[model samples]
Target: MFIDRAVIEVRSGKGGDGAIAFRREKYVDKGGPSGGNGGRGASIYFRANSCINTLFNFRHGITIIGKDGEKGGTKLKYGKYAEDVYVDVPVGTVIYEEKDHKFIGDLNEDGKIVKVVKGGRGGKGNACFKSSTNRVPRIAENGEPGETKRIILELKLLADVGLVGFPSVGKSTLLSVVSAARPEIADYPFTTLIPNLGVVSSKGGESFVMADLPGLIKGAHLGKGLGLTFLRHIERCRLIVHVIDMGFSGRDPYQDYLDINNELKQYGFGLSDRKQILVASKMDEEGAEERLSEFKSKVNEEIIPISALTDDGIDLLIYKCVELLKTLPFFPLYDSEEEILDHKVYTLEDEEPEFYIKRPESHLFVITGDKIEKYYKMTNISTDEGMMKLITHLRKIGVDDELARMGAKDGDLVQLCDFEFEYFE
Candidate 1:
């Protein structure tokens, strides 16, 4: 079960609400607000694990949620913060945060980790609203909400050189002889379903990775045989080793070479900027030399002929590849992803907190405002003492003054978000 891509939901924990309480000691001269603030929420993180190669585990679990923060308590005791959740993925994974189509972190290097979702901030307690004018304040804030997002994770195999040619052209055969990788090989087309990686080393201890990707057909780019699957795997390659079958047995060998290169060019990096080597396979066939000679004149590119079956010209191919790799610049194969540096921050002048709640919605006072919501989260509403602390806290915050300015009379019906009460001091 070699999974290459996966989509999952990630959520950070919400912050805990603040506690609203007053100092009610027997000998205290005057008891003031003494509520504690709520705890911070847990954040969601993505870690890169070199041991993992596939996204098979993610398939089973689509949603990953973090633990919520503990609520604040009385006696000015702050709530406990929750631990963050870490989701481990294999290296070379690229993630795209779907909301804004923004590219996230590229987990190319081993042990690279990234924080995906941010946790909500904890609310303030009533004690924070204390002031000289008002001794008793009655307002506690609720905890902030954590961030949630859905993203796509794709795996790009790291390979130094990629083998490109038509199906059943002996790309896998050449790989078997040169490296320890034993890919499924047969005489039929599309025999190798998955891309196979092999390590080729020289006598001087020079080594490079090779990928025997699925074959490319004439319409591969347009959703033909192996189609986009083959093209995507080779995107990271520093070089394209074009394997041409001069002794096609029936099909036009030259035409086959043209079609494959056309597909590569059409798919664009246009990878034409990268290094390429032309190699004629199945050289043991009769008249292969004749066709090879004619093919060179038509194509006029550097061609290395080889018989992968008997290991003929295999060494030369390796030598040529090692030589080419030496001169080429080292480019990361996980080039599909670009590092993202900034996050989207929304800001609007005079933007009011506006949200609607239906009536008969469980005594819900539809309140509006960022400051108010944050205050509520920071408030601890568990105890009556805490509630008093909340009210006194709110009063000190000039909520009472604001309400008076809004034209409130004695015994007037007052409305606040999530809670409603009769107005009278």
Candidate 2:
């Protein structure tokens, strides 16, 4: 299976917590806080691999998690940071944040590494809190949490020219004759389920890649056929080769050409504006010559007449394609970073209050703030020193003053996050 798109969840490791300890020795007279700090968390990264051509490797819902950092030890010994994790993807893979549709990075070159998530920072140890006035401080902080994200990965095939036309238009046959790619060929429509890429070298020894895209019908832009599924592969092509079957069908070659162009125009993304070469296939058929003449009269541009079975006019077509490739500029798959920044747009949302104080019931006060909630989650309230640190932080941030202004009395019940305590004046 040639998979091109996938969705996966990734998470970075959290930092280790700080340790609190006191030095004990036989001859040492003065021993203060000796706790060591925790180590930092691991980070997640994505690397490009040219050997892999499809996204099928990530078919399953894989959750990538980084290794956690080692914990701190006694004697003020800091913990070791964890190693970062790297996931390899195929070249030309583009990643986007699933929720907000934000563009993360594009992996266009092999061995390119992009940091997807950053690890959390480690907390400070009790030794860091020691002061002259305090003398024997016993406070230690917890490490911060790592980042988590869900992203979408899309792969676009890298090719120089793309062959697009209705079904059974000698696209696969032409690819087989030009390069080593042997796509499935049949008389029925939609024979080529997936895009087939081939390398063609001109007589001058210049080589370029060509892609045999799936067939496009009248409503292909609206996703009526395989065109909608494989149209993305055409975005990277520098030129388009429209192969028209001039024999064996009741459909007019001229109308068929117009419908395909209409679909390309509707698909947008500069596909219709791309340079195109018209090739009328099966010229050896009985009515092919007459149809080719009619098509030529209708369209003023040069249309190459070819019979893939007999290998006639294939050389001239390849030569023309190569000549065009020399002058055409390479099209980048993504927009410039400056272009993205210049078109800035803001998302409006209801502004949240800095802090909220509410009384769920009589004498039961609830305090909540984004910052305070995060602090509460990281605080270790099992020890008396931990509780004191939390109280001091709240007071420093004016939370206590805000509570007093809200008619909070002495010994009143106060709740923050999941922890509850008695309020004091």
Candidate 3:
């Protein structure tokens, strides 16, 4: 259940609506609007938790939503704000904007938190819009909508050195001897299915992390053996430890080294650029001296031959790894603010008001926009009072002028999206 990658949709909360009320005290006569404004919506954030190692927590989830803000109250009392939502992930977890594939955050340090989505701002009440000329205004704004996004989370294990070789090359055994990591060891190929990490400390008390990646076969890049699954886990490593079976009893050590290198090259993810160390494991077996000499002649570099069972050459390898760690820079990767998104609210008032006219059988009209929809949905125009209210609203929004410009007459028929009306003075 050590899942490393997941895709989930996230939505921030929407702002609350503004309240519309008037002062009704007995002592005060004709009081103005006393309504309160709405509260702000909840934000969405992502926090890094060191205790976690996988993205399994995000499983079984397709979307996450934050709470909406509370509505405004009377007597100038503002509504309560919604609580923010938090998504926790393990260290080394990278957040990417799935739509654009942009990097957002790198959870390198423990307890680091980053805001992924900001909540919508609350709308103002009619009371705030009241003026000396318009003291009894009955206008109020609705709540703003929240932001929605789709993001991808990926995890890469952070380590100092990565051990890579062909199957059954004693990589697990080397790690078991050098560090405290226990990996499944056997004679068969592809014994290590997953990457195993270990912490190796030197005599100077300096320590570094090492990972035992799965064995790579000749066609690893083409889905052979472990395929390219374990190759991705080693991209974050600083050094590559080439553990060849210097016992050279079964295969040529030089050819094995070249074969693994070629796989990394084919993968082409900056793995070959990393610092590599030459170490031949299983040297205790007979006829190892001739193989070691031949391998040295071919490689022409310093090679450490180790016998993991006898605990020989373990300390020297640890020391060499530590020394290499000191010389290299403390390489750190970072993410920028461009990974997140900005939230915006859209309202009908801001849209272009357009109405259509057609003569399918005869002349007909169709109107669309913020004001017309409000008159259709909120007005009960079957009654004379409702009809009067609709006319007053339409006139206030300049609907009559628009109809005249479109060549409408007293006998013409008018329509607002789905409603039809006979024109009159």
Candidate 4:
């Protein structure tokens, strides 16, 4: 079973909580805060492995979670940092965020790696807050939360040449003859469901990779038959080898060539403009020569006529492909500058507001934002000093001023996260 696409959920580890212990040595007097800071959480990364060819390992709706960091220890002993996790995927795998389909990364080369999510920073201990004016601070911060996301993985086979045509066009047979690849072949259409790759070597000691892509039908760009699923695999091909069935009586050889080219044009990605080599397959058939003559008259490009069963013209086809590949350049997956820019993920660090206030009712007010929520999660609010410190920080950040400007009166309910308190002043 060849699987090329999969969706999985990944989560980065959470940072360890800070300790709030104090020294109790007999010789020491008034031992200040001795708590240690927490360690950083584990990160998640995706790496490309040339050995793997499919995403079948991740097809079972797998959920990958990074290891959490160890908690801080007493006596000023810091917690241990969690190890990062790396996942191996096939080369030419493209990842996208599931929610918005935003492009994440493309692993087109072997050993290529991309960090999908970074671990959270560790929390500070009570000793971090101790100063000349303040001693024996009892506050300690909690661990930072981890990040979770659903991502989609798509695999596009990388090859120098891609063989494309309608079903039963002797594409698989040609690949098996020219190279070691033995793709499934049958008399019916859509027999080859998955793409097969082979390394073809010419007699001149030149070699190149060839892919036998799945069959394409009319309206394939619109997802009619085996659709865009296999068409995307063609994006990585440097040269397209269009195989036409000269022997088949069900469809006209000339019209077959036209329909397939139309599908490639409609699919975009500069596929229509890419370099191509036309081949007439099944030349040993009774009316194959007649069909090839007609196809050549209708089309201006040179077509190599080959019978895969007899190995006739196969050597010429291989030599032509090897010679042509030496001159053709590799096409980038994204064609335009705008398309490349669209894949980049931008962060609004300074442009976004620090916090926002929402009034759900006449007597209720809610404060919510990423920055404020992060501070709320880290603050140790069990002690009076910790609670006072949080309140002072909130006031310093202009939360109090914003509420006052919004006509918030004393005794009105003010909520931050799950905690609700009465507005004062």
Estimate the TM-score of every prediction: 0.77, 0.81, 0.71, 0.84
lDDT by residue (143-185, candidate 2, tens digit) is 7778899999999888889999988888888998888898998
Q: Going through the candidates in order, what is the number of backbone clashes in each?
A: 28, 0, 0, 0
Clashes of 3: 0
Angstrom error at residue 419, model 4: 2.3
Q: Which of 1 and 3 is the better model by TM-score? A: 1
How many clashes in candidate 1? 28
Q: Which pairs clash (backbone N, Cα, C closer than 3 Å) in model 3?
A: none
On lDDT, the candidate that comes out on top is 4
> lDDT of each model, Cα atoms only?
0.79, 0.85, 0.77, 0.89
The sequence of per-residue lDDT tens digits that candidate 1 reaches over residues 70-188 is: 77777778888989888889987888887776677877778888898988777767787788976776667778888788998889877889999999888999899899999999989
Model 4, residue 228: C-alpha shift (Å): 1.0
Clashing pairs in 4: none
Which candidate has the top score in TM-score?
4
Off by over 4 Å in 1: 97-102, 249-254, 326-425
Which should have the higher TM-score, number 3 or number 4? 4
Give candidate 3 misplaced runs (Cα > 4 Å). 6-9, 24-30, 54-56, 62-64, 97-102, 130-137, 149-152, 218-223, 249-251, 266-269, 285-301, 327-425
